[model samples]
Target: MDKRNQSTVTEFLLLGFGDLHNFKILVFTLFMTVHIMALTSNVLVIVLVGVTQSLHSPMYFFLSQLSLCEIVFTSNIVPTMLWLILVGHGKVSVAQCLYQFYFLGAPVIAQCLLLAAMSFDRHVAICRPLHYVTIMTFTNQLQMVTSCWFVGFTLTFFIYIFLRKLRFCDLNTINHFFCDVAPLLRLSCSSTTSVELTTAMVSFLVILSPFIFIVATYISIIHTILKIPSTSGRHKAFSTCSSHLIIVCTYYGTLSSIYIVPPRDNSINMNKGLSVLYTLVTPLFNPLIYCLRNQDIRNAVYKYIQSFRRRKVVL
Candidate 1:
């Protein structure tokens, strides 16, 4: 409103799980364990894909990129969350909060596009098997990954610009773990209608569009699998993309719950819980899912372990 009445808020107090008054230490321990596990698992995937010769296909290349995104996405929020859980609250300057938001959004948005690209890779491999090699060349794969990161960061940068324009007066407390767009918009004194509109457009572009593409891609894949007369043929075809399908379901399901579904009476708590699914649980489970389900990844891990053991014995 009036300039004289407004007090600039240089920082925000993140009230993360503050209600766990008697269980702060327990919660902190749990969060710390998950954070460490998630980082380790994702890093392992990246390393395996890079060093293993058999794992250098387009599929594994995309999986490595996905792991990289998970590493960035989880690391951006979980450390702050652990600190907040330990201390009951934490202060983040305005610039720092915006930076946090940017890092958070960029990886997620990039991952969304990457997932879609992965699905397309699967579709080509199964539905158009003859053309798979020529279509999914190293150059094409690099271009796809580059575009995902570029578009993801560029779109989020615009949202950050809009967020910076809003004035925060007096109110400096965030209910959620990190600086999410919803809580920040609520605390802004300036009109957020335009910002919300811009966010909506970007969400559609980055989230909804990619999800739809993945869905359509899977439909074709299923159709192709069904046309195969032999049962083993169908199974083989299905197995190729099943890991990606599971991840797509988990990722989009949690996202839809948090953002697309209508909020209920306990929406704030519900949102927080669902946020944990995508932000923490999904990343932690991703590499696990791929490792358990994909035979190549399993073999790679086994070979790497064997090699390490042999080297140790020699030394």
Candidate 2:
């Protein structure tokens, strides 16, 4: 093939877990189980929030948005992976790969920012209780959710511009399961240093900035909690923030390890494991955390179940 022809790759082969060929069925089963579970849990949260009038608060509103994002995020990547595992080989067109990357990137960014917004919500509720209702009204919550989605979708253009310019040459096989930025960059024949640096910088700014803001907001929340004279008041304040804190810790901790911190090994397998943590595990856990830990959510869910039973009996 001529150099020009070699540089042009119309499609990409998703080389997903080629080493696991012997256990492909096992892998497929595991992934399918997790994917189904993640989807079911997140969707349940969304439905519960929608139907339960008591859950119409700003916090639950954000939780529902997060659940929706999780649904979209996992759907974009997991089904393709299942198909590839079942069929043995999967080819994705250049356009398809780019769209996959865009879809994945946008929600991940939006979720990060949403976590920050959730933290700010907690901050307002705890530290500035008197002004919480005024500050985090439905209109403000809607604007915040919209802003997170908008910024996440808009920011992809920066990385995608450079990503689109890269020539694949003869390398058209994506090492990882999905069309992740790191794996895609590895397949490019050209030097991706600038693109890599740009990506790293963008990720740091987008992720770390919100993370820092969340930390500061929590500090203020903590300070306020300590000042509360009654133990019950302090417990109430802590309970409100705990789920968000756990999520922040899990999401950002895995995220920073993958993107922000210096990588210990840039191996495909290593990245795959880290990717699973954030992409699959985190989404699965979010709804479980909220439903199990938060008394309000649990009560609402219980009430919903009772109502459902009562309606079924009547019918």
**By summed lDDT, which 10 consecutive residues of candidate 2 come out lowest?**
259-268
Report the lDDT tens digits of candidate 1 across residue range 1-315. Answer: 577988999999999877687788887788788888989999999999999899999999999999999999988988888888788888999999999999999998999999999999999999898999899999999999999999989999999999999999999999889998888998999899888998989988988999999989999999989999999999999988889999999998898787667667668877888887777788999999999999999999999899999999999
Best by lDDT: 1
Give the alpha-carbon lDDT of every model: 0.91, 0.87
lDDT of 2 by residue, 235-275 (tens): 98898899999999998898887777665554557877888
Which stretches in model 2 have alpha-carbon errors above 4 Å?
A: 1-7, 19-22, 191-194, 264-266
Give the C-alpha miss distance for residue 158 in model 2, angstroms: 2.4
lDDT value, residue 299 of candidate 2: 93
Q: Among these predicted structures, which one has the highest TM-score?
A: 1
Model 1, residue 272: what's the lDDT? 83
Clashing pairs in 2: none
